[model samples]
Target: MLSTEADSHANQSDDYAVAPARAWFAFVMIFLLMLSDYIDRQIVVSLFPHLKEEWGLSDKQLGALVSVISVVVAVGSLPVAMMADRFGRVKSIVVMASVWSMATIACVFARNYSQLFAARAVVGLGETGYGAAGSALVNGLFPKRWHSTLLGAFFAASAQGAVLGVILGGVIADHWGWRAAFGAVGFPGLMMALLFMLVPDYKNVVVRFAPKVQSKSPKAFVKRLYAALTHGPTLLWVCLAGAFELILVSTIWAWMPSFFNRFHGMDVTDAAKHAALVVLCCAVGALFWGWVADRLSQRSPRNKLLAMCVLTLLTFAVFTYAFTAHLEVSTQYALILLGSFLMTCSVGVTTSTVLNVTHPGLRATGSAVLALFQNLFGLAVGPLFGGIISDAWGLDVALAAIPSIAILSAICFWKASRSYEADMALVAAVLRQEAAGERVENTAVLPPLTAAQA
Candidate 1:
């Protein structure tokens, strides 16, 4: 019996080998999971017209609903990261999907803006956990060589989901009403969580179904979290870059539809159609950038994120012009596509850079921290801030502010590359010492090294 059980386990391990087929399957799953988040986010914006009409919401009130959701997602990111590190990625996904599924379903009950806002906030909590855990899982599953490519594929799915959510929600709202649209998209997400159960877990180069036990306690988790934040310039810079990127991305997602609807005097369907084109362009851009990053990484890892900085600056200009320009429908379509492609292209680069420098065991924690900062500044500040600006200065002037933010993000990302190179050396050295069975002290601090370190 014991021998037969051992043979069964051996066969299972053998099946876990990195076949191309399996890798592609894992990529598909990651893409699907990412799509879920995009649907959740995009659905709200698509339904905004119906909801505004039904509830008679002011711009300020609607802004509050979006802001509250961002705040919860930002706050939830850190704790979720810690949970991911202490537990496992799969478990985190399970809990997050369940929580968000319920929160989304609860949206059906909310007749007022405040009630709906509260439900959205709860949804944010689940989304945060899912984002951190899912990203880490993708990193762990794929080889280092293709990390950017795989993650880029995942990011591209976000654009696809956005397109689907906007088109589907808008069509449904036109026909059925807003509540059914929410339940229709939100309920399927719960099933995706269940599907996650079939996926294997990756830990220390082994794939297993059972949760791997962690030696670290909650106290240690906190300690490590502090150490990571306070002791690492690379991590700080990367997180800052993420925050900046999110700001631009979030602003675009939250308000671009409104921008089109109001500025072009188009109905929800027409606005969504344009937005769908933008989303498709973004998806294409994401995949292209991922391919570029993976190719460039063979020469220098820094190229991964450096490319992002350059593209972001370009995107800032394109987006600003797209929103501010008073052009014909054809011209408008061209500008939106150009802007989206440039903006989303950077996703693969930025995500790969973060994952590459992060400590192996703390991938999820680090991702969480990045997500938190990004959400706080990007999601929280960008959309609401943009709305306020639109309210005060008009949409054109307010949107001009997006390029400035994007430029700032570009600068931060560029600066982060230098610090990241240095940190990679330090981490590599620490790992080397550990391999030698040396109990190296001062894990938090390392003196400066020559260019060789970089």
Candidate 2:
């Protein structure tokens, strides 16, 4: 049992009951920061041509520039998230945004490839816990009813930001230089970080899972974290299912432009735009499924698992045929668009599910754990595996083969469905106990930590 909301919000008051306007402001700022985070991360993709021309780099080296960020972010997320949980998300975000933004701006002065690569790694480090912390912030601020929908919108920002990054990077580079692209995207993030300071901080929830005497101890904290993360079947399966879903998403998004160029005879630019359109469709699907999931789960929390299961099945069916049926180019692209939408059904669902069962005090850390799985197992594996398959059997075969992963993801959701209700109920009880305990303490002679009071 670990959760505490605002003083104004009673134990059962939807956290939004107090200062709803402030919650909206916080969400808006966090949304901008999320957009800026991905934009900085992805803007480099569009600069590949510029880098290759200026430095005479190979494709492999150019690719590493992007891959390194994912690796660093995957590795760094947990520790940063732990610190965020202990401190405050707003302050941590301010520091992270400043570091990453300055690092991105620093790329403009890079002397060579190594310098640029190092700067990108710093960007990853800064971004490590942002998603986790942001998700926690928004989820805690809103009530359970809005969790799926708002989280859906929050997650959609990543796809939207990536699209903006590519388009803005290319456009800015064409007008100015590749260096200017980094500066353009990075500066706005720094300014947004400054504005974020105005958002109020949620009252820090101490770890109720630990004994009060040992609550702040590092060893106790780690043990409690491990227990929370590994305690239930829901978190484990949902994480794996989400990772598998991303394999489908990342494979298509990374290689589809080349797939079209190679198989359908579309030019590079048109093919890229074509892929972007599919991702935009995914963005839409995330919101739609979020709504659907909320409606289905009104009776029981576990119904959300069924939504993800159906979504993955739909993705598998659509992608398998689109890639293998030998259809017309237009027909295939249409199916790919549908597949894209279907694959994103778990975006908000996965994170919201994680938060639902997690101790509210550990919400941000729980999100980081999910982020770790997604970045390391899902995002990292998808594009690389697709490339490996492309090298052997060709792009069409690779894309067609990847849909089989959706079957595995669907299986995971069904397995998760078994225990989700139990796990969610368990955590809700814990939250209620902790919330009531706080009320008792506050009523009983609580005192401030000050020399004068002592």
Candidate 3:
């Protein structure tokens, strides 16, 4: 019996050790796709001044253009994620990338406000499921212990994409034209979609979620989703925390270029350059914090949750000072960079938390739920609310006030910390049962366990 157990452990270890080269290559390809995804989504923001001048648009209208995508993405995420779960993740990703790429190309032909808005909505439709499905796919490719660090790096691609979008969009718009920026950024995703087909699927890759459910029915999917959302007290609070964080993040991403252009008297290109630097700082922060969370989580899951709560408060304080203080331009920029970095620290941690408590069958759906809250409350409302406030008072006042939502976020994350360990243990119990060759339903409910018991 001892030899048998040792052999089992050795085989598992060998499996993990054999697949580094192919696994990392697939990871890089998927990471690049995510990078392209954000570039297409964010490129429009860099053209805000040009769009406002040419279209005679109001701040509300410009903000609406950004918010509408989030609204669509929020509305579409669940259904599309379900489709990915029912269908194949690789196939769904290819199709999604293709659709969004085409929609972005359609932006080049948009002659007026309505046409552009419609195109952007379609872009959102194509993008709605990509994040959830992509993350789920990444989870299947990497070891469980690496989820936070790798997903953090994966998600950090958004910041890099944003940086590229703002900087390259501004430069391209200046040199070629705003329409050219759309075409230039949009075409790469299509080629990447083709390249993605060559990467191995979950079966070939050998890194798969243990004890996965094989259900595919819509009813089963819905039930699994419901189970995932209600699996523990922590999921809802974590989702809410993420939503609030995105509220601050979306506002910054949507408005910072304009903030610099207006307040610092920089040209559009120069303003985007500065904003890009701040976003790069955010990317670095996401990776740093994710790595920190992974290391701390090695000691206890509560440590990562506590870290998120603390970072939220820190983010709020720094951002408030950046916006409200009458500091010098350089000083304010420094503060904004600091605040942006702190604000993103929770990205990977929250994602890993959700996945930790969720069943493998529902990970994509779980991710979609988080995205739904984030988009509906954070992405959809944050920018539009800021726009309204800016119209009422000024842009600076709007930024300062909007980020105070982080206080609520900190509260939610803190509350979640209380229940996280127990919930994780519950998930582990279910996975263990399934690994023991017992048939497990998606909606199987396990009795609660206390933290001490866990």
lDDT of 3 by residue, 105-183 (tens): 9999999999999999998998898888888776766776778898899989999998999999899999998999999
Question: Which residue pairs in candidate 1 have backbone atoms (N, alpha carbon, C) closer than 3 angstroms, thus clashing?
Answer: 247-378
Which regions in candidate 2 have their CA more than 4 angstroms from the true location? 1-18, 48-63, 175-177, 208-223, 229-231, 260-269, 391-394, 435-454
- Could you give me the TM-score of model 3 versus the true structure? 0.89
Model 3 ranges off by over 4 Å? 1-18, 204-224, 228-230, 440-454
Q: What is the TM-score of each candidate against the true structure?
A: 0.86, 0.86, 0.89
Point out the worst 10-residue segment of candidate 3 by lDDT.
Answer: 1-10
lDDT of 1 at 425: 74
Every candidate's CA RMSD: 7.1, 5.9, 6.4
Top-TM-score structure, candidate number: 3
Q: What lDDT tens digits, residue by residue, belong to model 1 across residues 1-454?
A: 0000001111112233245576567667667877877787677777767777888876656666667767887888877766665666777787787777778889888878778888988888788766666777677666566667767887788788888888887888778888887888888888887787766556432111112224335554454344433345766677777678777776776676777888778898888777777778878988998898778767877776688788888888887776677778778668777877877766666666665565554566667777778778777887688778877887667666776677887888788877776777765665556446553331222122223322
For model 2, state the Cα shift of residue 152 in Å: 0.5
Report how far off residue 86 is in candidate 1 (Å). 1.6
Candidate 2 structure quality by residue, lDDT tens digits, 393-417 = 7767888898899999999999899
Q: lDDT of all the models against the reference?
A: 0.69, 0.76, 0.81
